[model samples]
Target: MLFLRSRVEYTKEQLFKIEQLRQLVQKSSELDVGTDDTFLTKFLHYTHWDSVKAYQAIHAYYDFKHKHPTWMAQHPIEYYRKLFYATHCRFVMPRTDKNGRVLVIFKTVDAFQQFPDYLQGLIEMDDLIFESLLMLPRVQQNGITVICDLQGTTRNFLRQFSPQFMKVVNDKNGVLPFTQRIVHIIQRGFLMHVTSSLFLPFMNKEFKERIFTHDGKHLSKLREMVGYESLPAEYGGPADNVLDTNLIFNHLSQSADYLEKLQHYKKRIV
Candidate 1:
């Protein structure tokens, strides 16, 4: 068995395999993945520092990205904001979970008015999130907390889970940076249909355990896991909720200037 080299013990063969796997990826469509030191290190940790598993994980990641390029493409700022203001999705400010892992929140409502064709947009945003998530500093070794809020939503989110997409989700999800520490699902009683239809088949035993279902009355627990103030008003948190689309759009436009400078700096270190 292979182990993450520096943290644990590893064989020479494992070391060779790491390089071999790196070469394999360099030749693949996702030429940049599985080759960077950060990714190599992160994948190792994800697999208990096992080199072979790390190699396989890296390959799966690149393969998934190539196979489903649209799965996680970054869209324009206005496009993303529309999805957020439409009441279908939102990515609150990044923070850490109880375990210090990066916490990512995704809030969705019943039907997205005007933009009824939410599958493509929601799916795009989901992919964009995971991609952007990789750039986080805490993302390398620290894990992730994916919160799915379906308190007031319909099961429409599951409409995209065809056999093809299911395979894509399952294959790539396993190798994503850090283990999925917990997938906190709010309003499980009313939304189990959504979870069962879309998520259950993609989950393994370990993944299923990481997923915790909560009733509507469990905001305290939600708050405890992910601090209440960080959540938006819709989630019963103190943060500013997008009250109007025009204002939200203006906010995004303003944000682009700041983000350009911020992302420029972010590139050097993260």
Candidate 2:
């Protein structure tokens, strides 16, 4: 955190680059995102505090979004609301991780539900979840730790994985702020086995490295890592304050009415 604070202090050349990048983005896209200090700060952080690299990253992100317009396009908050309650619910806990990072729970049972396009729902959820995390100041700083509960991943879901989806996962992961702290894979089922044996090679190296596995008996380890008070009751922890994906969905869209405006691009998706 200290390093980030110190590195963000700009020299004259960096200021010039930031301005250049700002204009470049303004000219290139419909979003007034370049002018946003928060937007550029992500690029700056992702590029290891190099303003030039940050600008390049912004350009790449712009190009990527343009090339994949469908992926970047916004949807109704109601769509997200429904997807939240779908087979896969990625809800944030009412608590933080041991390192003061946000803890996001990815619990799934029947993941291949047909209500919404599975792949697209995953992407949209990623954006909404990150937006929700940013609402908490500590997450905006310390990032998030994911609890990927794979207790009931089906064989059918494993067969649905594609190179395109994996690529999107890696690409989008690079752009997001405070993205990965740790990804705890609880209950090593067949899906986890497939992911490690086949799909792991395709994912980002850092993402692969941070994943830790545990079975049902050791669920308390997560409570120890974060806190018993922070975890949800279903996870065998003591957090009595209830939380659900729908509540999390509401938290992200609460500040704005983009659905009424029919806006095509959500601010957070950028």
User: Once model 1 is optimally superposed onto the true structure by TM-score, how far is the C-alpha of residue 186 displaced, in angstroms?
Assistant: 0.4
Clash number for every model? 3, 0
* Lowest lDDT 10-residue stretch of candidate 1: 261-270
Each model's Cα RMSD: 8.5, 5.5
> TM-scores, in order shown?
0.66, 0.76
> 153 in model 2: Cα distance from truth in Å?
1.1
Candidate with best TM-score: 2
Q: Per-residue lDDT of 127-179 in model 2, one digit per residue for the tens?
A: 65664454443554567788877666677566666787667667766655563
Could you tell me which residue pairs clash in candidate 2? none
Candidate 1, residue 104: CA error in Å?
A: 1.7
Best by lDDT: 2
* 1-270: candidate 1 lDDT, tens digit per residue: 001123434467646655765666565553443354544555665776566677677666655555565655345665677566656355534335556665566666655456776666777656555544443335555667777776545546556567777776676667566644577887656455465557667777777777876676657777777666555455566656432334324434554443332221211111
